[model samples]
Target: MVSRKTLAGAVAVVGLLVSAQGANALSIKEALAATYQNNPTLNASRAQLRATDEGVPQALAGWRPTITASGRYGYSWENQRGTYFEHANYAASISVTQPLFRGFRTVNSTRQAESIVRAQREDLRVAEQNALFQAATSYMDVIRDTALVSLRRSDLKFQEEQVRASKDRFNVGEGTRTDVSQAESGRARAQSALNTSLANLNTSRAIFRQVIGIDPKNLSARTNVTSLLPKTVSSAISIGQEEHPSIQSSLFMVDAAQFAVKTAQGVLLPSADLLGEASLTDSNATGNLGPESRSATIYGRVTIPIYQSGSEYSAVRQAKEDLGRTEILVDVSRDSIRAQAISSWGQLNASIASITAAEAQVAAARLALEGVIEEQRVGQRTTLDVLDTQSDLVDARVTLVTAQRDRVVAAYQVLSSIGRLDYDNLGLSGARYDPTEHYRLVRDKWIGLRTPDGR
Candidate 1:
């Protein structure tokens, strides 16, 4: 049987091969995974999640036994009627205390901390999704730019062919000076378009490289345009609402606030605990004596609060208010997520339609340009008309390429909104790097608590 580490390494190699073909080739999924693992913003969110984990221990401290130790030394001398005496004393003791009652403060506090941890975990998830979504968008842009460059180069070839034909016709005295001028102008414009497209392609590739942690300059690949859009808007909305990280994170916030109220209630309740201590002491002086003996005392304490000048009451009320406010926030988040789902769904559909329309436009423009060129050869079309048709063809091609790229990006955005833009969904081929992993490792040691999920 293959070991897990070996399998992971193999998968990583395969992933590299998948994105390293042709010129400036990279898959959107691979780029997303790289961004998810390395983006600074996502890493920061992971840190915040670990910080929230400390709340657990802070709350637990209220319930655990408290121990304290102290030591003291004293020296004294007296002289009277030609007699002098000196004495010294030393004492050390340890004390232990356990809370017997506190208005349910410990219980409420622990629960509140748990809720906050949950909220922060969801927040981490949301951040990861956003990072991956950004990477996907940038990846699609690079692909589109690369394709448009190729298209522009092909158009330039056609322009060169037209120029050659115009020259041959002029040599036979069958074409006018204006016809040659028109062909030459068309060729020049096509070259300019190709140069611009190449520049845009390079910029887009650089952005993808920064996002995916891999250079995408020598790989050229095309995507299937028809598969860019989802089949149903209703399904997209439903899925997005269920998986969207922001909404889930907000839901956890409500849980945390409610727990805060519970913690406040704990402040007024009774609690139970056991405590023990040890001590040693020595004294060289005693009352009216020349010598003294050492002694030690150890004790435990139980504290019960009856009044606090209304501070406890205010704390409880404030906690309740916070809980109520968070509940409202949850409601607001739900509405906002629903609205976002609907909006993203519509935009995805519109982008898909635009892509189709743009493709049709490119095809029509190409045909029109060809027809005008033929008419120019026959002295039936003006030089300006031929030039205009060539420009239209180039613009249409570029527009179609951009529209297709946008459709792909929009599809990924819809998935991200639903909270599904995770490593598994992206189909990354290596060990998933969770930025929270290190934080989780140290959370227990730093906070003195068990994992909330018991993992």
Candidate 2:
């Protein structure tokens, strides 16, 4: 019992391997907001998603017209029937080609690009959830470590008082040498334990800073996300399997791969294009000049593929196999998400029970410690007995502190495992980042050198 709190706090501190701002310890929502706004991982993922946004326009390019201009000039000297002549020739042409048909490759390729964009958006969602989870865990760890340090200090103070009382009684010839020695030894150990707890608190504070982008202050710790979770574990699993971003992303990948197979198969079909061209040519000699000539023409072109070494067939087969892989991955993601929901649900229930048990144990230990101290004063108990009881009280209080932290952390885990731990779900205050805004801005874009935000 004396060692349990020390072990729990020590473990949490070691894991902290990163706090809070303002008057009160930051609430879970506020910390989540901070992470959402400033975390590098989340921001980078958003940027990556934005890059994916351009794929739609690129795919749509297959349906657009291509225009080109060319100009050529040449000079020549020739002798004809004893007469020397110098001639110069120049030509200029402009042409435009609009795709009339492309075996439906453009349509399928565009659909595939759109599907990839959707998948990347889900990837962004996963990043957001991960950052928020880290922030919440770090916040709770700081609170637990801080409470353990306070309890350690109080226990140290109690031990110091015991040492002084034992010394006074021994000077008055009432307490034995063994009692004084035990009291002094217990006081030393308590001091050492307090130092260890302080170190743990410092470690937890460092981790808090790393995750939440701030140092820990007097972080208050009262909020849990139980309301965001489903009422039953099975419900949680069902929700997770349905709503988790990993599953959604993988499903979108299946869609993209299906479209890709079609796009590749389209390669074997004929393509048609309508083209228009205009040209002007002029010729001049050293002593003779010719009138400039102008010409214009419009034409329709078709390209029929007649088996070029089976590359397109290979591509079609490869795309079909990739589609199969993506479909299997969808099941993989769903299975992982289901497991996560069940494990988080179990942890939440266990934490709730532990908290209740720890509270009762703390109350009983405090009463026992008081009784032991009074008995020591009345010559019915020894200094060592009082030290032992006080240690038990501190351990009980530490257990309660750790259990409370666990309860809050477990609630958030349940929320995350079910794919409900996000800015909107938590109802965080601030401007939410809308990925669709970027996707819409870039999807149909024809020409641009800079981003929508002018960057």
Please give the CA lDDT of all the candidate structures. 0.67, 0.83
lDDT of 1 by residue, 297-416 (tens): 444445555787888789989988887888788778777777766777777778778877876886687668667766765778776776687678667766666776676677777666
TM-score per model over all chains: 0.77, 0.87
* Model 1 Cα shift for residue 3 (angstroms): 59
Model 1 gets an lDDT of 0.67
Clashing pairs in 2: 18-206, 18-207, 18-208, 18-209, 18-210, 19-214, 25-219, 25-220
Tens digit of per-residue lDDT, candidate 2, span 85-116: 88898999999999989999999999999999
lDDT accuracy of residue 225 in candidate 2:
73
Question: For model 2, where is the 10-residue window of minimal lDDT?
Answer: 10-19
